[model samples]
Target: MTPADLGRPRTPSAAREQITTDSRTERFRARIKMLGSLSCQLSRASDLDELFRAVYSELAGVLELNAFVLGQYDEANQVVHVVRQVHSGTELPGGSFPVGNGLTSEVIRTRQARLIRQWSIDGPRWQVGYATEAEGFAQPESGVTVPVVSDQRVVGVLSVQSYRAHAYDEDDLLLLEATAEQVSGALRNLRRSERLDSQLQRRVTELETILASMADALLIVDASGRIVSLNRAAREVLCIDDSAILFGKPLSHVQWREWPPAARAVADALEPIIEALGRGEALREVEAELRADGRRVLSFSCAPIHDEAGAPFGGVIVFRDTTGKREMELIKNEVLWMASHDLRTPVTAIKGYTQLLERRLTKGQATPELVANFVGVLRGQSDYLVGLLNLLLDYSRLEAGRFELEPKRIDLVALVNDVVASVQAMSEGYRVTLQTPPVIEGDWDAVRLEQVLHNLLTNAAKYSPAHGLIDVRIEADEQSATVRVADQGVGLAKSELGQVFKRFYRVEGTRRLEGTGLGLYICQRIITASGGRIWAESSGPGHGSEFCFTVPRYSRQIEQRCPRGACCWPSPACWEQVSPRLRSRRAQA
Candidate 1:
């Protein structure tokens, strides 16, 4: 053979086979290059829509396309979610379908590739769902469906179909399978990223909710002392409406002079804590006071935040207003002092008088007049001691939730008049006037009502100037009765009005006066337990004060006593008069 003939196959059949082999090799190389390019495109895709477009474009280059479908398999529900569907180069609406008797379902069920060469014979065995049938077009004759698997599990399916018979060969099937394998990895990564993003967003929302709801002021700072975040309470404590002015600013560089006086004082107090944070030190329960707005006390804690490796990354601080607590402490101390002194004075007087009487009797200087005078003095001291002791005992019982009321029908107007007369007899300079409807009866504890009136009148007498006026008035409505006791006394300040009802709380101006500070508190407790409300009102100091309370005219206990079909009165209007027993007793008198 010649040199040129040596390069060629010897027989005609061999030469033709060689040519076919060369063509196959070139097609294989082109498919490999296409797969590499597709992988690169998928990696660069920013979203699912972009990834779907890339996949469709790459697959179209190598396959006869009449319809293309991409779906994610939901194994738990035994269904596929079609993410993208195209028919005749036109996009179609995508939806989900059950894993029924269909070619796509078979591929997903077997986790393998399916090749249908001719629709008339093979399509009937594995029928297509309504999702696959395109209206106004001939039925598909051939198709290829492959499972997109990852981690030994099928996650999705990729499919292509053609209207012509024998359209796809074994080579096309292999190419589609390889493409599905690459897509499996990319799809897995995308879903994983989406799950992580959803979890992170949920965590951030929960954190924001907690911070907003906190009552204590919270502040977070980075390692460089730059402010990272502060809660609503922190902004309120700093006395700033907008917190944007403080974000990303170093704590030490804040303009204290530009802040309000109260905020400036708070900032000054934080300086030492800031320095400690810089030194990586933790501080707890550090208290400071600001006198700029009356008096405000703050208790704060600071700690260094650390990473998982125990390296310091930043710091956090939480503070709360403690002015009420500090005031309570002061009030407690003052109450203790007053209790001790008041108890001792009565005891000392009794002791001294007893000693004096014993000495006089031993010296044979006792006379009836002298003994009588001494007895009177001793009796007065003993009564005073008994009253103080009772006050303390009542307070303790109320605090322990043991104080109870005995309710009965009573004339409120008569009770008030009696209390006024008794107080007037004891008080030399005060004149009390009553303006109330005659015989307005209510269901209340008579003894407790008397006690309330006695305490209020005595308080007015104690705090009033000589000849001060004490006015008592009563009014009634369908549901309740209101009583108001007003006195021209050393009235309470606006701030003290709310505080006066607290146990062991006395107005600062009234500290020098004689009291255990429990009378008003006990009054409030009694009124509240009777299904009522009590409050004090005053127009600042030295302007007179009024204490008003309301009680239900007919309490539950009273209703239980006078049930339906067995009552003394026909209607609630009958409560405007005294009870029959009282009326009869008055008539006899």
Candidate 2:
């Protein structure tokens, strides 16, 4: 018997019921198979379009549908258009659905499934050409649409059309609903993944902007000793031509070999810190030097980078350019050495000549005029030599960090008077006078202060024209004391004022004037060391000049004593060990 003959014929109601059960079962099995295949396709899909095409094709093939279309909403264009399509017989016309225009629109608008059993009624009624074409091919007399919903809103619709009358049943609706659920879950996941990707891109852009603005060179290396990130300054300093070559590539391959010795020392020192970090110790304030492209760069620091769990991931190095400052220090040292040598040679010769004269004269071998002449030359050269020696000693002490103060109470008025008198006594050519305040007390190095006053007085005298009046003044207050030495000498040039206190710096116009060029510089150091400051002022060239300095007040009382006949001891070594009783009696009387 044929298969159709062997099967028993059924009544209309029984056939209808049997067909409904079988159709429902078939749809349920098809959806299950579609879900299984689609899951694999979803995992393999690299992009949205690929996933959409796979989902659409798999659903259409498994369901045995007449046509299938996947629509994507064009937010910018305000339209819903098909991205993937499968047609069995008649071709779909451009697969597009306008907003609120067709059966697709009705399903989207209501967010509900719509079923149609007869194509002639459902297709023309809904004005959906693609569905009508599918309906005609399959002779579908009944159909159903299931809305794919995600995030409480309908994203799309999945429609299945049939040829037989009343073909769809409750089971078919349940199976289509399950398929819609899978598609909705995929859409939600796609949206989440896209948002995460966008956020990551924004964070990277923000970090890049911040790094570009830094002044010092900053480089970040990864666990494998490869360059991961570099600031704009690092790129410019190292001459990086390709970003790709730098990132993930070993730092040694870049310009590390060409760095200066100091920079290399910094790099070598950092290796230990990196090693320590690798061993799980946190490194902070680690200093390193990096040399790049033949330039000397002084890097100030290195620090380890930490991961989310506070594990050491890599290191960040920060460095600055110190070439200019280092070079300046070297030049200053060399210049100071040359100046000391030049000044010491002349001073030493004068000291030898004066000592010889002093020895011979003490032996009483010379007549009065000859003794007087030799004594005069000896005094003159001795003073010149002493001035040069004092300046050199003071400057050297400052440089060597050996300068210190032995503070004492002193009379500003008496000191000025003594300094002026001594300066006047040294020469008959220039007239010197002291303008005084009665008293002042200060904690100061008295000898250094005296030397400063003596140097200023000598400069004033030497630069003044014959018989020019040099005025010295002492002004005192609770907070400070100012001593001013005004001379009617050729004033300093405007261009020379700024450099007057620099060691060995002198005005070109003052070459004819006798000086070692260090007197003013030494004076500044001594004044500053004493918690004071000094400055010079001039009206103009050839007008005259005034030099001033202020020393801090001692806030202490001065000891009661009578004016001394002479405060300048002939020799410091002998004076230091004098009897206190005699010294006090001499000071009082």
Candidate 3:
């Protein structure tokens, strides 16, 4: 009575307790293994779609399921794509659905799992958004829909359905909810990777665009001396064509040197770049200047580029075309030299001569012939100095846009004769010839035009040798009259023709010539202001030159209306009859 009665109820209760403890332990271990398996599967997924499919296939072993579909929400488009679906019994709809209408939508909206057992075909909840014809589903079904939530927000939904009602209970819902969390994390991570990749691609495109649009040359070379990147400006400066690129080509390769035309200067410019690559370390900036053409000057710089750790990776070259700036600098230097030498020499000479004459006269050592000869010498030096000063002053006035013209009508042919007569009277040992019609005329500044002719005659006479014949030709058309002054003198180089009008520009090796460089420049300015264009024609040095300029013909109406005896050119209306009667006076005396 003692053993049987005492152990009966206690023994049965203990057995049940141990059984419950074993069941809980087994379920816990199984849940842990399932989670580990799911994690392993998701880790191998490269993209979101692959993750979706992985979760779809992996969750089947962990849960009681008949039909499954994983839906991802596109909140932007308000649509959901059924990324993965697996079923053999009840047929579901195709691959997309509107977000706010289905059982899956309810879970996303609430961030909760749904256990809908009574799937009445005509029920209000099921009938409203049902795709019966498209889904081909037999009703009276049961299912559980769990939202895949991340950071407390639903990103998508995972669903499983069964053909019988009351197919799932609270424990099944618990397992599905726990599995939904892992799925959400995997999908989130995949999405983040995709967004990062997209941003990287966008940045790469922007960099390429920026490099292509740059105006200055930029070149990037690798540590191996191979060209990696070159901008549009680099290609243009190097004269590389569009049919090919410099990429992956070594800088020292013989063909690459020729690629840039290496024309004596470009070759020198690339030398530093080649050396920088060979050094394999950061290099100081090396500069190069190139004068390929007479007009444009190119400047280049090469330097080694280093990474954040101060380790040298490769090198870069930057090129700037500074033609205008170099030309301006050359002009400035020339002006400075002229001022220091030409201007100072004449002033100093005049001062010295004056001092010497004053000293001799004070000592009473001067004779009458000596006084006259000294006076002539003094006068000549004074004139020369004054001419130099006048050139500088006139050039500055013209540059500052202050030179003015006083207009009057005059016979240009008469002005030429006057210039030739005056120049010949002043300078000897040079013969002058005139070939012109007597009647050609224009509305011009008579004094200034005469001065212009005199300057040209004087310039020709100064450059010519003894007994050299200076030919002056005058021609006219309806719109303008032209004069040509030809000389037997040292001709200008072809390059000098365009530059002769620039202030302080002189031919190479001609600094020995006695004169300021402003003569031709002033002549051009005067001619341009008088409504004309002027230029010089020369084959080359030692051949000879012809200086020519044209002045526009005066309107007949304006000339005819002018008051007589005041100032006016002989209007065509007045000259038409007389021009035919006057014979050409060609003189070579």
What TM-score do all the candidates reach, one by one?
A: 0.70, 0.48, 0.64
* 554 Cα displacement, candidate 3 (Å): 11
RMSD of 3: 11.3
Q: Rate the local accuracy (lDDT) of all candidates.
A: 0.81, 0.67, 0.71
Clashes of 3: 1
Residue-level lDDT of model 3, residues 489-544, one tens digit each, is 88889889989887766777676877667888888777765557789998888877
lDDT leaderboard ranking:
1, 3, 2
Q: How close is candidate 2 to the true structure, as a TM-score?
A: 0.48
Per-residue lDDT of 51 in model 1: 75
Q: Please say which candidate is ahead in lDDT: 1 or 3.
A: 1
- Against the true structure, candidate 3 reaches a TM-score of 0.64
User: What is the per-residue lDDT of model 2 for residues 192-251, given as tens digits with 9 covering 90 to 100?
Assistant: 887887898888888788888988878777776677778878766555544436688655
Decide which is better by lDDT, 2 or 3.
Answer: 3
